[model samples]
Target chain A: MHRRIVSLWFPRLASDRILRINPVEAPFAVTHHEKNMERLYCLNSQAVQQGLVQGMGLSDARALCPDLRTGPANLHADHHFLSALLRWADRYCPWVGFDGNDSLLLDVTGSTHLLGGEEEMLEDIHQRLTHSRLHVRSGLAGTRGAAWAISRYSKGIVPQDKLKIALSPLPVAALRLDDATCTALQRLGLRTIGELMAMPRATISRRFSLDVVRRMDQALGDQSEQIEPEAPKISYAARITFPDPIGLYGDVIAGLERLLNRICNKLKRQESGARALRLICQRVDQAAVQAELRLARPMREAECILPLFERSVRELDAGYGIDQLRLEAFDVEPLPLVQVDANTAHQDSGDALDDLITRLGSRIGLDNIIRFLPAESHVPERAFVEASAAYTSPESKWPRNQGSQRPLRLFSPEPINATSRIPPRKFCWRRMHFSLVKATGPERIAPEWWLDDPSWRSGVRDYWHIETKQGRRLWMFYTPRHPAWFVQGEFA
Target chain B: MAELEQFFPLEIGRAHEVCGAGASAFAAMACGADRSDNARTILWLQLDWQSDIVNPVGMTPFCDPSRIILARAKNQQMLLSCAEEALRSGAVSHVITELYRPLDLTAGRRLQLAAEMGKATGILIVSEGMGSNAAQTRWQCSPECPTSVSDGHNPKTAGLTVLHWELIKNKKGTLGSWKVCWNAQAHRIIVVSEACQ
Candidate 1:
């Protein structure tokens, strides 16, 4: 079947609504109300038939019709609304392009097969637009320019070779020519395309202009016109509409398995893996929910992504049963196939650890599960640290140690008041009697005054590595002369 | 504006100043660091008391002062559980702890020697009444005014946590008690919120 193309146009569309407030069947013509007003003001033709006319100041138009609603144009909103139609048009055809502010050109080449046939496709697209509460004019033709002209002039299809006859009755303006060219052609009594086509091209150019001939040549396909169509921003989308809307956990689980497989298949075929997935659910009353799942690593596996969705489905607001499901993957990148062990098919040990962490993380949250990384610090108390399970590994080492003997345990030094200078005989702490046994010298380690380190607030430390009578080895230190002993740490 | 959660409000406690030789090494542990100087390390230590502990749950959270009594001075101290805990909290800016008996000879030398090599802040909570010679500060708390009464709620206590706290001995600050709020969920002292009594 030959593909059909359609172009739409709205002439006096703004004029019919602006100066003359007749919303429909309003015959109007719009000229510049202000000198610099670009495309502003429309003439009310229906109102003109009822004694309303253009160049009659807007105030007079309002005086002629008391209920006439007058308003300025919103050019930006118009463009935005038109762009939205451009996106919605994607559902019908792959090659929908913007024609103008009030028009859309659909290349319904292969798309007619989807909606049954050519007339049906037009009716379907028309019905969709009508349901959206918009007024539109459509025309189909074998040529782009002919379709545009016929849509505005005749509101029907202009078959191939019938272009000259179809565009004949329309005004010279239907040629989409500039005002100067149209006025020039009108002055020469060459007011129609057919009239102009029959005459010598040299005479038309020689009398009026040369650029009109170029436009005229291109419209007739004598010269090739290349259109730089914008392709959709290459997104990843997979969707499934359910025959029966199911709400059970088992049903959603089975559906998710199939859905994830399909999505992963698409990503794999595209040579990419999904970094993020959005699950969209359509339900009762046209209400819908879109749940997004983010991955720490880009992934493409039914085993990997499905389980994540299963747990995540509980968080989705299904609201009156989901009838349609869609999954879109984004932030995709090429993934290498994981070549694995053939000798022991069960020996994928690298993933075992990550799986355990992923499960634990899914429960208490990934942030709460952490592992310690050793730190490089000379301070005994600052030698170790913990990192979240997601960003770091459990067995990573922090560069520390390489100094003096660090106590496995460092305590707040409790002072033992010396009753005598001969390093006390016995002191009671926690009501437990610790008798002094084998003693060591007072290692008078002064605070490093040059560095101004704060932990050394006391003048100096006379540390003693002593052993208690109970055989519990102790490391005590004293600030002697102004003599007071402190229990700092223990030796294993 | 944010009302700090009745628990840890994403605000990890930070050490004001770290010293000893290896102070810089342990400096990274300050709750979070100023963005400009980002190299920081925090070591959190959780010491489960085997009893004989006064305010075992670090009332001042992390501060300690000491002097040697004549008898225990000849020998030293060892803190088994606390040292293990500090090595655990890698992101804790301050090495805060509480101990039943002051760290003796072996313990003090180990910690001082440890601080000398790295930048770490160790705040040990020592009982106010027990006078030892090793700790830097002996923190003690006496009951202040009875907790206020509101409607049917008891003024002296709220839920299971103690609310009113007073600072007894601080080696670096003006020697007096400052009020401390408490959180039961986090089991830590909440810093004061009001201007003054």
Candidate 2:
């Protein structure tokens, strides 16, 4: 049974063309991106002939060949281009995935028959990408890693099992050990995969690392090597265009309505609600700026989203004008289909209504809005946390003991200015004076000693509930370390 | 839990007599505290934006109480997002946005009525100078808690909070300035007792 696998390696893809630009014919190397002002990852036999040697930096490379052209790598663009090739490669094999960052791997088991044979299928994939200005190497073997090693190390028309032999002579770098590991291996004088294979099992296991053994097993098909494909992100967005670019900020509001309607319609179909919205304004000079809105609830409705865009109009840079308007639902949460009773649903709860929230969320980033989360701790300060507008589901209770009314705000522990060491009569704190009338609690809260965190360096805290003659109730605390008293909270 | 939400009815006394001519500032004041002391107790909530935050309502349904608490941010769009967060906290009387510049009168009226009907208080926290334009009461405030004090050796950091509020304008007799100690952990503020001092 033939397995049709296609592999493409764009080693000199960057340098091959620079040779044509200025005609620096002899040994000039093509360099990848620059690390700094000087160095370049040189592609040399092609480079050295043109006075471009192995150790030259980009500036040095450029100086080596005065008229040499340089190209910056575009990884995202490359991925897009790679995806397009994958689409085209479907004619040869059904399973195709990327390998080693710059190569494509395909499994053509049971597919080669349609393409005439293994050779023809390989030829077909190679011809297609090459026709589209991409270079590839074809290798066929029983295993994925073996094929990979053969493609990287072996010569043209590598027959089956030729790789098992060829791989032995190839450097350990072919096993994909990172630079540091490969350099370490080279320093250890175990340069080739053959040397690594020859090393004692105990020594390689104890000295080198597990990765070396894992790579060997994968190459020999003793272990499975799986390629994780990137999952396509869930994106919900729609756009509209006008005959003439709309310049007025008010004009965009109407368009936003249309886009919002479309977004809501799509979300409704999916039984989902949007937590965030991004308004992309495509302007002149190919410029685009996105205005976003975050919702506190999983919401879907034009009324909820429209008013938000109304507020955002003031922030938009309505340059030469917006030729295209796009509204994308950025963060999404599954909207559980709700059975809205006609009575409660239709009953107008208030004159202002809930539209204000949607309006506001879409205007600012979703995260900017936050709600308080009740935490598990009783340390007044640790009792609650600030939550994002859409991260949680609604709960029924404040989730706390209903004994005392909590102050609407809590201050970090502050010094309590008092005349005496004990709970004093009156004290000055921050230019103000106060006297305590009622008091409770010296609840000693010790820092958890198990987890040593620096912030808890002050050993323990003793809390007190104190009321002042002026009718202000306070949750004051005294640190035992220096025996200092300070006010921390006030009862509402 | 539902009882707690209703515990604070988004309502103030006087049987729904709306405050001054439907301004955002007026509506916020009309829904002010109803204590007999005539001191409209106010809570100043400050937040830090450094980490991941959960949705308030999701954590507790009480946060979605009827009170409409509007929030003001650096920009108009930011107002909505902030209000949604306040709404989830369960105790805001109404959400009122005080913008840097005056908006259309209809929008202000819409905001005021929306705030009142929800039994929530709407607050327009405009720039200190801007609120003066439409506010029934303008407050010139200093920290209620003194942060630190000067020690004989170094300027010792004062740990207590003390805020002084002066009512620059009001429909009733001018309320004298007040000095209150803030207790953050308990989320309460206390009126300092001069006699104890």
Candidate 3:
């Protein structure tokens, strides 16, 4: 099979993209900062005709063309436009790839016949792009390198028999060599492709790099070059349209059930589960109403997922009636198939727990549901960390600390009025007076110096387990240096 | 029956209430005592407005902190709904909730029915006074001065403080009160003194 590659180059993509939206007739140039200097990145045809070339400093360009209008170059926007063009070029060839930021390479092998032969296909592509006001220069040849060289330096088709004669007049830079290598070749008087071709292959390989010889061989069809085509994105969405608009809740649920079955079956085949799903309900006389569902864990079962959407779907106003329903499964994760025995069918409690968490999270947020994990810190406040139950896996065991006693309920430290430091015979907390019946004291703990904890700025603390006459067991601490006391927790 | 006499046997598939200052401590002890080899998960729920949180380090003396799942609800309605949902799932062994206000009879009955349906225990730690509800047991827990040390300031018994548990209401058994303390080495509550009514 003969491989015919097409190269399409957009010479002024950045400048033309701006001009297409806000049409400017005067000479305009797009400038970008490079090496701490503003250089002309792309030039419009009007600016080029006024003797302003790309890479010229903005100051020099203004001197050359006094009426030159300048705008900042948005390379990101230009790249996105070029990608959209690549997808648009899919109509001419199935295999199309990006060549640099400004060009595209399409291998239209045997499919060009569908658009009435190779010449007609090129003409069609040129007319369509020009209709969209994009400056496109295209070349078709037997090899990718030859097509690329002809597209930038020359335009038109290159015959297979006259490939050498066709690329001979082009400069050595046409072979995609580095600036230094091209300068070196030009210094030795090897300026054109024909002159470099006449040199001995051994000397060229020894003196220059292997790239020079490889590029020449690839252009002349001796070495094969492959173009990486972009693959189409696969969307995991299913949609169903009813012949007549259905408004009842039961009818809508029936339609949702069918859609869920279709999407779940697709997920099962790929061994993937949906973590987040979106449902779009298209109405007859109004715009679409949408609802979203988030799962605690990746799930693919239709039965388990259908119920989670029931409340949200019921709340969605059907307006006049819903004529179409679309279900899309995003945030997909790989969930390998698990083999279950018939004897253990009723013993899968993990799924039930996850389902419950998902239901509760949809109402009260998943962040509110948490589990405790032990932290390696002596500071009482930093001793434990909370992890979301919906996201984190359950730990098997917690590391046991056989240290000093800790309070059952911990709260922000509240200052209490006490007369003396020794467990205060009488103190007031939360506007309530309590007299201490028994007191255990003075387990001194120092703050971690490395951490500038605001609560620990009171210096070292001496803790006490004090029981009150009113049957209140409180965890009290007194700062020796600050001479103050605070009630921080309760044994309850 | 004799083996269960030493410890308060919280009936499975039923609702219970604990009030007063040491309710949370009593709930933790009950959860630890009822935990078996298969039953591990305990769901603990609290209101969002409440500033106090359960310290994992403190809970380690009674229950394994890793076996607990904590949730905070915005209001009482959400808390009760979440408790009922967790109980009805049958995924956890026990569901413990901290109620700011007293639970009504209807809400308590709903929780009881859900617990019975799922075969899980439900424990409510109420802050306010208890109302008439369908709970199987109601307890009042308070702290008691340590009697082991005469001076009440001995360093040896510094970490050992006793709690007084008064079983004020019981449908299945007689009312009683006992002074108990957590034995860390045995991982169980031991009775220091007992009083029957």
Candidate 4:
């Protein structure tokens, strides 16, 4: 069987897209900044008829037509629209790919009969796109290269046996060569593809590049070119469609229960679980209501997942009635099966802890529930790090600190109104006065010189564990360079 | 000392309150005293507005910081709900919460019921003096200065932290007062002397 390929070209994609949204009668052009000048990127049919070609400066284009409307070119939006068109083209055939910025290539081999024939498919696509106010030119042939060249230079279909004759009349620029290469080939009296092919292959490869010969062979069906088809996304979704729309809350819960059972059973078979899930309720009035859930751990049990959705489902308004309920599970992870024995049953506390974390996270977020992990630093504030309990497992052993005793509660250093190198006789803090009874020796701790810590800008500190007469033990540090005392923590 | 050993491990499945200057340290010691083989985790809840945070480096002297899970709540309602949920799960051996305002009798009763249902201990660290609540016991803790002694050259007190705890309210035991210090090397609390009334 012969392979059939189709090429589609959009002559004025940028200008047509803008005009489609807001129709204009005057000539319009899209301009982009290049070489420190605003040059025309694409033009509408009205602008083309006024003799304003692409790459012309905006000033020059204004001189040609006084009523020319101009807008900046948006390449990103054009590419996004082209991809949407690719998905729309999937109805014609499954093997659709992007050819260039302004064209699409579809391989309709063995499937053209379903659309009546090759000629009928092309005509149907042209009529539909034209009715939608889009200008599209299409060509069908046996090879991709031949189809591409025929679409831009000429119009019609090329049979499999006469591929060479159909592509011969097209200009040498249609062979997908650079402007410099095409100009050089034209200088040698080769203006058409037929003339270039009549020359000796060895002579052409020597004078020009080997790309010329390879392109010729590909267009003639002598060299094979493959088309890469876009893979469809895999969806883990289950839906229940009702004959009659249900508006009761109990009915919605019943429908959701059935959907969860089906989805959980499917996940159990694959030894996988979901960490994020989305529930979409399609209403009969053409409106959709969605609720999303995030779990701390991957779970597949129907009973465990059902309660998490209860609060969200109760809040959803089943406007008019809901005809369909769809459940989608994403962020999947592999969850191995564990057997339930006496020893394992006793260790179910871990599962209960995970459930508790998930419930709390639903209210206060998982980041607020934290566990402390020992950090490798000697600084009092940097000695430990906080990690979310949902993500990090608890460490079995914590490295013991062999330095001076640390305070029970730590605070960002608050300066006190005392200026004594030794413990003061009395000091005021938080509107209270405390008289020192006995104090320990100063433990000098130098700042880490490698790091530029703003908090440690006061240079080296001399720490003292002071006992006050008011039954309060405070950890105070004095900076010798700054000549100040600051209370950093409490021994509560 | 023998009678103190019986008090070392506070009765499980009950709710207690510790207030005053040394409440946090006393509650940390109580949480560390649970050396059971089955329950290994401890849940600690506090308000997000509290400026002072528990330092893991300092907590190492009482309990292993790795065994503690800290939860910060936005309001008092969230704090109490989190404490009740954690205590009712039975996954943790103890649930310790720091309360800025005193807990009412109804909320205290709910917490006590949760602890009983899960067979877990609940400890509340109140900032001010105790109020009317359904707690099993109430303790008032304060820091006490150690006695200074002169050896030969320099005169210094023994470098151990001393605290005085008074049992202000007890439903099942006698009210008493004792001065105790934490022994870091042995990882236990030792009674220094009975307070002179």
**TM-score against native, each model:** 0.41, 0.61, 0.79, 0.82
In model 1, which regions exceed 4 Å deviation?
A: A1-5, A9-97, A106-135, A179-190, A198-210, A226-235, A238-255, A280-290, A307-326, A330-492, B1-197
lDDT of 3 at B127: 63
- Answer with 1 or 3, whichever has the higher TM-score: 3
Candidate 2 chain B, poorest ten consecutive residues by summed lDDT: B13-22
lDDT for A233 (candidate 3): 56
User: CA lDDT of A224 in candidate 1?
Assistant: 48
The digit string of per-residue lDDT tens for model 4 on A1-492 reads 999999999988998889899889989999999989999999998999999999999999999999999999999999988887888899999999988889899999998988799888899999989988899988898888988899989988999988888888889988888999999999999999999989999999999999999888888888999888767644579999999999898898899889999989988988888888889999999999987777778999999988878767888999999999999997788888978788667567788888888777766777899999988777789888999998898884666757687899999998888886777889988788888987886998888899999999999999999888787899999999999888888895
Candidate 3 pairs with clashing backbones: none
Chain A accuracy as TM-score for every candidate? 0.48, 0.67, 0.74, 0.76
Q: Rate the local accuracy (lDDT) of all candidates.
A: 0.52, 0.55, 0.86, 0.86
lDDT, residue A376, model 2: 65
Per-residue lDDT of model 1, residues B88-172, tens digit only: 3232224434444544545544553344333344444444443333333333332122223122343433422222223333334
Per-model i-RMS in Å? 20.2, 10.1, 1.6, 1.4
Fnat, model 2, is 0.04
Tens-digit per-residue lDDT, A240-340, candidate 1: 88887867767766777777888788777777777667888888658887766655456788788777666667777776788888878866777777766
Q: What is the fraction of true interface contacts found in candidate 1?
A: 0.00
